[model samples]
Target: MSKKKIKADSTIGLTLKTMVISPIALAYLVYSIFQSQIQSFDSISTSLLLIDSGIVTALQLLLFTKSAKKVSLTMLGILQYISPTISLIGGVFLYHEVLTNAHFIAFVFIWCALAVYTISSITKWRQEQMKNEINMEA
Candidate 1:
């Protein structure tokens, strides 16, 4: 019933919906193609994956921006940077791909930049929340 609880529930709902959206879309696409016998693996190229993922990334950011009251775009930027850095590292290790020291160092630099952004966003959001609380009390 409380405002915080309502916000939390809304965020949870948004997250679940976002998680399900991609799978449901893929399922639908597969179903639509069920009648076709011919299939080409070339349709699933790297550029296609990048474009699809970019669209999803944009959608998630837009969703979070439209849904969350406190979080800023900067925070999302930081998370986006850090998360993919980690994912890339995992991909290299898991897929047994070639990863040089230069790649690791670049990731570290990106991570550091993201850390600064994360701290700034958190501090900014906290200050705003405190001000809101003070205003509510007055």
Candidate 2:
């Protein structure tokens, strides 16, 4: 399908999902308000922070879905770590968070797994390309 069609389809699906979920979400918000569970914002800054977070989350999802179509599934899976890895680095350096032995071991194992996956994907892709070339030559 064309990119335009795919985008239109995604928008339609998003709209349908929002239509179904929005009412339920609104009901929950109403119930929370009735139960006095909804707290008033202490400052405009806090409300702005909440709105900013929502906007960032929505943009992340939108961009992720848009780029997902242009890459292989394996690449997409590998790319999923970019955000968390940045967060981990930020926590360790900027936030002065400590990584325990367990965290180190987990990171080592994850890197090993990713390395294996990437190597195998590259080998498979090369084999497929060679096969196609051979077929074209024949």
Candidate 3:
């Protein structure tokens, strides 16, 4: 699709998402008001958090979806691992979170799954290349 078309589609999608979610948000806001769950809104930190979680997060997701469309499926699959992996590393090193035995086992399993996927993908690609070569020779 053309850039203009893609932009238009993204805008429409974002609008539709907001339209669908707005009512639920309004309901929650009302509930919070009646329940006195909302504290002072006068704080700059609170305002910044609201903006970051609502607007910034939506824009980031929109951008991510748009960018993901431009990459190949295999590359996208591998790229999906990056964020969680980074978070896990950060929790272990930066936060000094202890990696328990279960966490270590799960992490190993996930890496093993990724390794199997990568190897299979490479093997498939090589097979396809050989098939094409044989067809050319024939």
Candidate whose lDDT is highest: 3
Best by TM-score: 3
Across residues 82-109, which tens digit of lDDT does each residue of candidate 3 receive?
8999999999999999999999999899
Q: Where is model 2 more than 4 Å wrong at Cα?
A: 1-8, 16-40
lDDT of 2 by residue, 1-138 (tens): 433336555556556767898899889988987888977555788878987987787677667667667886777789878788899999999999999999989988998999998899899999999999999999
Ranking by lDDT: 3, 2, 1
TM-score of 3: 0.79
Model 3 spans > 4 angstroms off: 1-8
TM-score list, all predictions: 0.43, 0.73, 0.79
Global lDDT of each candidate: 0.68, 0.79, 0.83
lDDT score for candidate 3 against the true structure = 0.83
